[model samples]
Target: MFRKRSKTTENTAATASTAVRPVWTFSSSGWLFLYHFGVIKCLKDLDLHRQVYTIGSSGGSCAGAFLHMDTDIDEVVRFVLSCALEARSSFSGLFQLKRYLKNAIRKFGTAELPNKLEGNYEISVSQLPWLRNRRITKWRDMEDVEQSILASSCAVPLAGLPVNVPGLGYCIDGMFSDSQLIKALVLGNSYFAYHDHASVTICPFYSSRAHITPSEYVPLWWAFFPPSPEELWRVYKLGQKDARAWVIKNRGRTNLTVTPIPDLTDEPEATVLQDGWHAWENVGEEISMLATGAVARLWSALSHVLEALGWTLVYWELAVHTVLSAVVAALAPVLPDSLKAGGSTAMAWKRCRDYYALLLSLKMVLKMVPALGGRIRMGMDAIDRIFSLSFCFRLFWFLKQSA
Candidate 1:
């Protein structure tokens, strides 16, 4: 969609002419290392990685280390796949896998790691107590850098324990704070006096801030389980595809003097006038899609509630009948013999007991209905998943783009 160039865009263009470096920011991609690995491979293939600035968080930090060190592409891929397998094997195996990854980072990582002031690499981590996100640029040595990477990648309650940064108390995943990479980018920009405007944001999930065309959202199971070879290959290829699309999209804006970019002459572009019209059309389409999806989901929920209510009414009717029968049976024996001539106390009591049993069964069935007992458990889970990024925010983005 065409958007009128804002002050940010204007500044970006102005900075682009003055040999601005491309800033590659990576999101906290848990277990999706291969995805960012693929993007790195593509960027390197296009000769874009050499002069780029890197900002990463969580799994992205790990990949940033690789990029900073210019590690072997194939080796990084193999190491990532192996780490995934090791982590998925057992709980203890995850610790072992972390150690292995740390060693790998230390082996490749230089003694002097990148920081905001001097280097092209920075890793973000969530600081404890206040629970704020901060970038680690300066390090004691490669060992410190490795530990920082561990702390950044450590997702509490799931992956492993939070690593305690020497002065930062117990630090967890950078995602606890800057899950979207917005804060990191802002900090990165400010460090460069806002001259570093050439941004290539790569989110593992589909994000509005990313340059690449959004890929399929990764399932939560992939975070804990090692993907099969076929699945891994698919994600890798998807990354490559999106990276290429990013190159094509930004080819027109990049400065030619920095590096020789591949000429994607066959790719088409729309004029400024066309863009405005198309932008409005896109907006309309997105609005309609969102409205339709909302209506459909509401209808589905309503139908489920109505069905449960219908079943509840049937069960309640039976329960009411049982209660009335039980009362009559119990009262029948206590009534005058003239009024209840055919009823025996023993039979009446038995009938009352039977009615009580029937009432219990009806109560159990009522609780089973979705509108009743099941709601509590399901509601809690739904809320948890929604807040925990399990419920894909990309669904809305996907719907917007699908049209």
Candidate 2:
């Protein structure tokens, strides 16, 4: 006959097993980075997928919503890519009368994104009947909650309009209340803690320098959009300070680990769609270097190739000229009659001027390509500094024009 294990020993064994499952917390910045650069898949490969609890504000929340679906990471990447392409096409048509007319007509049939997300969430939850039974009170109630969450996640001050939930008043980005990591930790602890024992290790990833600048805010309309770079800086700094303080305060009591990721916003290789690519590259490289497996080596090689392609697409400068040409064509009709005999003639002249400018810019960029490539070969930091300087010059020029 086998001897029965003591209750204390059984409890200890259970606790030990639970302790191995880490609780992953992602910041708004971290989630966006992971989503954009395909690093979320790497988490599964690294065996860090268990007990993941995500919370984010703004773009982070957008990423979180995708993650919550429990679908394949590739599916999430495809969804993000589709959304980005849609946004690009929509914005490209802003000055085009024909496209604007088409968009206006289309708007009636299309629901706002928050509504779409709410409906999607309801359908997703209904499919998972167990989750619906466990958490949802009523379908309507669940829809409302999902809507509020999506709206709040997208509530950037100037970039996104504030959303009014039934009872929450004017909800904005959740970051205004607390950093993403802190909120996730508090929620996870409250819900998952039992008998004064934590079931998982909380690992929060964040970037301290994820502040927004004035140049980064592209206005949707010609409105009195307030310039708040100073305010954004202040908030970002305060959040970083408070986050560190909170981590220190709860260090030993809570099984918390904070991982500070490098900020890639100012990097030359990053782009609006793939800003987190550099960070993901660094992570993949580090892992590949440390691991001995052939799989790791293959992943590293693929990641490098993808990074090169992404950089080429984002920085080629020809795409900028193409967009400018379209803008000129669209705006020609609105120009003063003095500019040309007719809208068609005006458009032709504008196109000619743009093409000339594009040729000149292309020549300059091509000439600098070798130098830029050399600097990149030397180190990414060097390229970043050069890019930062150019960005500052452009920002100054914009400010001068605005003033």
Candidate 3:
């Protein structure tokens, strides 16, 4: 005969269970980062894959579809990288208005992206058997629905061509409809709880770092322009306010953890996209930064001491290298034309690699020495100052170039 568990023990067990399962929700920016940079690996590393319920719009939707399909992260990264590389190569040709319009028409007319997604990632709808009695009957119909959802998520105005769904009207960007974190949480909680009695803690990640300054905005044709610096700043502030409000509103009911990517303003490498079609041309780099930022934030949120410390070190290394590389790149453009040849580029790359290797060696040495972590932290702080100065110099250079 077994004795019954006490009420206190049951409560403790429930608390422990809840602490282990977190439902992850990705913003458009976060999703793009994960899509290109091993979302599955990150989730698995954190042991969050099985318990996660993802929600995303625009680029994030693409990630959500991949999760739903249970597709391997390796394949997702490959597909996203290939697409990014193709887009990068086609950037120059896309500058011509005629070619741009022709490509847009061809892409949207054939629902090229949606078709591609369906072909590459579609799986048996029987996996989601709960929805069998719903309007979607056949597996092909379910595939179409999933593809339509992804297409709609990525349909950014002016930047991405909209697709038409059979049942729905012309689909635009998902942000217009579902940018709020609360909606995703509500859906995830309700669906998962109903199905499995699972209690989900929301982990929301976004990449809207308030780094773009007023001075960063250069005058461009109004028709083809992004929001003004002031407007962008205002929107970012309002978004922060909204996020805070969300936290306050959801307090004590659902455990919501919000992780926003750190500002990239002081990263000299970020300026490389200044001359291009800002967001579109630098998609890969932006995605990479977003992924790194997310990882840094996630590292801070971990409960395991060893894992946290290890990831924190990784974050610092990535941060240091990013700032240093940007500084080098920024200074490169100021060099005399005679010094800007292939040999210079190769030399610069080798020097950067060697410098980073030295930093790694230093890290290993510090690990061997007791109580040296504090010294390493101090060194990081010093590097932060350097990053700030380099960023300021880069900004001044840009102003001169614009003038």
Candidate 4:
């Protein structure tokens, strides 16, 4: 889930009054995961440049002008630590919530992934002969139920997924070019065709079962992207990395595996499922270090570009959450009765911690103002403090005292 910056002018009175709330999210082909062109255009409409701020960046519009251009290993470590600390605050939580809530409200009542095919609900406006239009109408509010209707959803190399009809041919890198077949995938196209219960696979993986399984869209995203195991090794090789050499040099050990592609068909054109790439996932080399180094290279390049543009990483805290987690984690150690009281005690602790933080922050303000002014002040302060944590730390200390 994410919050979009309000379209309202950042300087406007109403814009100043916006409250932080959680944004609701749904995985879909229609939204969030737009096509390449769509995403470039959508980014233009976002609040990223004008209303957004980043404390450290390489190339985006809001890269902080204050960013130190001459960065070293130490600086990167410092920045990462700062980012991690900032993420754990109360205000950051609000940002997440507000983004989530705003997204939820903005995208409420939209279509969702299906649970299965031919189970219930309709897809693509087709009123199958066996069902009345009212039966489908009754389920418009339920996206999952609607998605289950004989949609052509696609699955990937993942061990488990919904099945409509198995692919007649295996797709390389999980790409599907077939129009009718691809359209069946909720991740591919939103189109659907009418099929009677007998024709339908009734399995959740079938994209044809649109109304049958709406939640299936998320896995589709990973299938669309992410490197294949082959690509992972190729990338490492192309980058002049040699974890294998390091392993041989240090431990005289090399992990090897014979991955076999599953032959699902008998034809010449049949693609194979390159399973048993367990060696790649299970390699004993410095795999994590290699992966991290590769990612860092890209991130470093991007950071440099964004930094040149004055973008900075914006940091915020969800503090009501910040201390409550600590209290919850430490309760078992500090309190003799904590284990016996169980998880509920920690939950209750969080609820009260949140309430008290809110109350305390409210009381910090002058009490004589009218309700509107007070609200405005609180909203403005919440917005202000999101950009910095000095005030939050003070509040954190106050909350601890009360606790």
Q: Among these predicted structures, which one has the highest lDDT?
A: 1
Error of 1 at 75 (Å): 1.0
Model 3, 238-307: lDDT tens digits are 3333333333444357543433423434322212113322222122333345555767445333312332
Model 3: weakest 10-residue lDDT segment is: 186-195
Candidate 2 overall Cα lDDT vs. reference?
A: 0.33
lDDT of 4 by residue, 1-403 (tens): 0011122221111122222211111112211111111111211222111222111100100011111122232333233233323333544331232132123223322333122111221222112222111112123223332122211122222212222212111111111211133322211222221211111111111122322222211222222232233332222121111212221242322122212323314312212222221121122132333556667566544433332221111112343344544554456456443121223555545544543454356423332232222222334455334312223333332232222
Q: What is each predicted model's overall lDDT from 0 to 1?
A: 0.55, 0.33, 0.34, 0.24
Query: What is the C-alpha lDDT profile of model 2 across 1-403, one tens digit per residue?
Result: 0111222321111223334433232233322332222333433333333334332333344444443344565544444333333443655422232222123223322324333333222110111112110111112343354444444343243334455444334455443433323212211111111111212212121212221111122221111121233322222233333333444454466543434423434323212211321342253455577767898877766655554443344343334534544554566577553232223745444544543443344332432342232123323553333233222223322333343
Report the number of the highest-TM-score candidate: 1
Q: How close is candidate 3 to the true structure, as a TM-score?
A: 0.32
How close to the true structure is residue 111 of candidate 4, measured as C-alpha lDDT? 35
Candidate 1: regions farther than 4 A off: 1-19, 91-97, 112-118, 166-169, 180-198, 207-209, 213-217, 255-403
- TM-scores, each model vs. reference: 0.55, 0.31, 0.32, 0.16
Clashing residue pairs in candidate 1, if any?
none
Candidate 3 segments whose C-alpha is farther than 4 A from its true place: 1-21, 34-37, 45-47, 92-142, 157-160, 179-403
Model 2, runs deviating above 4 Å = 1-23, 29-37, 92-142, 156-160, 179-403
